[model samples]
Each structure stands twice: as structure tokens, then as C-alpha cells.
Target: MSASRPVRRVDRQALQGLAHPLRVQLYDALVSEGAATASELGRRLGESSGSTSYHLRQLERHGFVETDPARGTGRERWWRATEEDLRTRGADFEDDPSAAEAYRILDTEWARSRRGRHESWRASRREWPMPWREAAGESTSHLRLDVEETAELMAEVVALMSSWAERTDGRDGDPRYRSVEVQANVFPNGRPPGVSTD
Candidate 1:
């Protein structure tokens, strides 16, 4: 979780730009794997260079990615995601049916990508060192809470994660440090069989 950058609230136009599956994958690759050339992304994603270059330009147009001037030669360009955290509210696009649809698509695809990454990690978990294998996993807890309480809990969790990220921001190039993914999902589950809403 890189919280050094501010979270971007996706607007209708940006939503449309990001709704495409390939664009979402491209953006996720840059965020998760760091900067890369379009050709590199194409090879990793199994897409043609022409296809990746086109989508990368579209992502740039929407402010989702930008060239990494520090890397790449004059003939090649490296791109990185502009923001690690992006959020969208359906309420913002309630009146615009198409934008609403785009929001749904973006949300679904992003979740799918997250799940895929987690699954991939699980498949390769044994290949990592013992310390990492011990640390890398998931946890779930169910609690009874009203809407406001749930929101409060989620906010606190996010704040803590951001603080950790900020504290460790300068540790780049450290041999002991590896890119770690942090995901938190907080939402109300349906009432338990014997539980009452009241």
C-alpha cells in the first residue's frame, strides 16, 4: 500500500477511461511491478506492443499514468501509475447511466485483478523464504456493527496502513525489502442466522 500519493477519486470521464479490462490490467501492472516500457508490459501481459502502446497512451490521457523520465533511453519510454489508490462513488454518477455502468465495470475488474494476484501468490508461496511465507497471508474477522461503526473501523484501518507506508517510504533499494501487497476489505455481511438488525 503506497500512500505517499493522495487517493484519486475517479470521475465519470476517468471511469470511462479505466473501465476497459486491458487498461485496468496495464495500470495494475505498473502499480504493482513499478515502471515499465510499453514493450515490456506487452511481453508480460501477452499483448502486442502496438496494443499496449495504444492503451498506455489512453491511460496517460486520463492521468492514470505518466512517463518515468529518470528511466529509459530517448527511443524508449517507461511509465508508472500516477496513483496507487483510486476510489469511485456510484452516487457521483447516479444521473449518468453510462458512467454508472463504467463504474461497475471498473470496480468488478479491479477486484478480479486483486483476487488473481492473491491467488498467484498463494500458488508460489512455497518458493519464498520462510520469513516471508510466515508473514504473507490473509486474515478475516466478523464483527457486529452498524453502518457508522463499520465506516469508522475501515477509516482507522486505512489510516494505520497509510502511516506504515509513510514510515517505510525511504527504504527503497534495501535488499531486505520486497514489494508487498496489502488489501483490506471491510463491509457488512448479511445478518447471522440468529442475529437481529435491531
Candidate 2:
């Protein structure tokens, strides 16, 4: 999980646009589903087509998403998240009241996810028809490295992960493996115990 290099940095305008609850949900839907038409997105979010389309245009205007690449013959615009991940200064965002609006986006997204899972009893935990499910595992290791070493290690990890993503191109995909969910992160936990990991 530690090795993949991030491809782009999301900036303030993009963050601000994604700050809206509907837009954020739209973003998540696009990212998870790969691409969706405005009408499809509207139905998924329980909003009207006009509303979804307007916000989608706003998203495109700000470059949060673009026309999905696979639609070669169609005239309909399909949208998806533009960047590899959503990023922000967590501490800074938490400190300012205005910045806290971003949390609304996240909260609404989570609520929607939960609502979809339990929308009905038959569809409760029993439902395997949902488009996707998530799972994760974590590990920690102690390391002593200067700033330069830390940077080098991160870059090497990214290269290795990208190489793996590349090498998988030729592999046979099981029908189940068509959807791949992978996330990797490495960040400072500050000085570990007594040592100045600073």
C-alpha cells in the first residue's frame, strides 16, 4: 500500500466545488462507478436530471471530472473524478469554521452509503447485489530515516506500486477481479515515543 505515487494534487477551487454535498456524492458515484450519465447520476442521488446536469457542468468547469474516455461512439457526456484522490489540509480545514463545510460533504456521503445498504430488509446485509463492498488491512513498522531518506523511500514505493499496476495489464481477469479497490498511504505519526522522529 505504501508504494503508489500520487499522480495529481487537487487544489482549492476543486476542493471548494467538491465541498457541496451533492457534488461530493456525485464525485464518489463517478469515482466508484467509473462513469455515469447525468440522468443516471441523478437517479442514484435522488435528484432531478436538470439539477444533476447543472452541477456536473460546474464540476467540469472546475476540472473535478471530465468526460470519461471509453465512450467513443456516444454523444452523452460521462463524468468521473479527475484526480486519483481527494486531498486537503486536515488540520487546517478543521481549524477554520468555513473550511468545516468540507465535513458536510463527507458526512452526507457516508450517510448515503449506509442508507443504500439498509434501504430494505431483503437488501440488508443479505444483499450481494450492491455494486461494491470495501475491505482493508493495515500494518505499521518502525523506521529511522532522515528527511531525504523518507522522500526516497516514498518515491521508491510509488514506483514499485505503479510497476505492479502496469504489469497486471497482461494478466487474466477473473469476472470477480474486474473491480479492483486499492488504496495506499504513508504519513508521519510524529516522533515515535521518546525518539525525535521529527
Candidate 3:
């Protein structure tokens, strides 16, 4: 199972060959960080330039991203996502086993990355003062909301988070205030006893 839940849905054709870890990471980076070059991606991701380029090609094959003319890089290629959201219909993923598996793998990969970051953040949390560390909370419950309501809530949450990200100027030139990574997961805290919704 994936470590984290998938946010965007992708189609069968788009899911093809996207199971690979590198390709999934590249796509997530592009989706989360906007556009970047092979070298920049390599530097940020700690992967080799050659490997970044290779996975980039795989991403292009899957129609995940396309080169931009505005930020020309001569030898280096810059990529941006084609769609705002990765949307998939019932037949695209549910009807195709391979595509479903690919989606699962991608979800797992993303979860792994998210877990790592969460761990790192938790570890570093103590370094900050109590005032800063005490500003967070956790929850455990079963959310009962209709699909449309849930989607609306998610959209509102995303907008609230993006409002922070969109800010150009923040607390000094400090790194944390300059940029922040937000991970929002709304789900049950633990398994309920002997209850299978399935």
C-alpha cells in the first residue's frame, strides 16, 4: 500500500511506464515546484544529470510535462506540467490493471518521500523554541462527508495553503520563512475494531 494517499487522479494512458521511482519523483517535483531544468532537478533531487534527463524523457513520453520556450536552456531542457490537475475517468484506471498498479506504485513512492520529510521535520522540530514547536496538533477520527463536500473542503484547504506559498516576501531572508512545504492529510487515525466498509 502507498504511504500517502494520492491527490490527483491519472488516466490509464498517462499511468503507463510511470511506475518507475525516478519518473514519479520527477513528476511530483514538477507538479509541486513548477518548472525546472535537468541540471536544476538533479541538484535539487540529488540525482545525476544523466539520470534526470533520462527520467525527463520518460515523463515526456507519458505526456506529463512539456518543454517551455520562455525559459530556453539550449542544451538543457526545462519542463512544466501540461495539466493543472491529473484527472482520470473510471475506465482509465479502474478498467486497466497495469495502470492501476502504476498508480499504486506512484502513490507509494510519493508516500515514502512524504514520510521521509515528515520524519526530518519532526527531528528538527525540537531545535526550534517551545513556542514554535507547540503550534501543531494531531487528530484521530472518522470523517463523514459527502464526496462533493469533501472535495470542496480540500479545495478550500489548498487555497489557504497556496495563499501562504504565493507570498513573495516573508520573514527576512531566512529559508523557512522564504519557502515552506505543506503536507495536509485528512483521514482516520487508526483502524476501527472489526469494521470493514468494503
Highest-scoring model, TM-score: 1
On lDDT, the candidate that comes out on top is: 1
Off by over 4 Å in 2: 1-7, 72-75, 107-198
What TM-score do all the candidates reach, one by one? 0.89, 0.57, 0.62
Candidate that beats the other on TM-score, 1 or 3, i.e. the better one? 1
In model 2, the worst 10-residue window by lDDT is 129-138
lDDT of candidate 3 at residue 51, scale 0 to 100:
95
The predicted structure with the larger TM-score, 2 or 3, is 3
Candidate 2 displacement at residue 158 in angstroms: 10
Q: State the displacement of the C-alpha of residue 21, model 3, in Å, after optimal TM-score superposition.
A: 0.9
Clashing pairs for predicted structure model 1, backbone only:
none
Shift of residue 152 alpha carbon in model 3, Å: 6.3
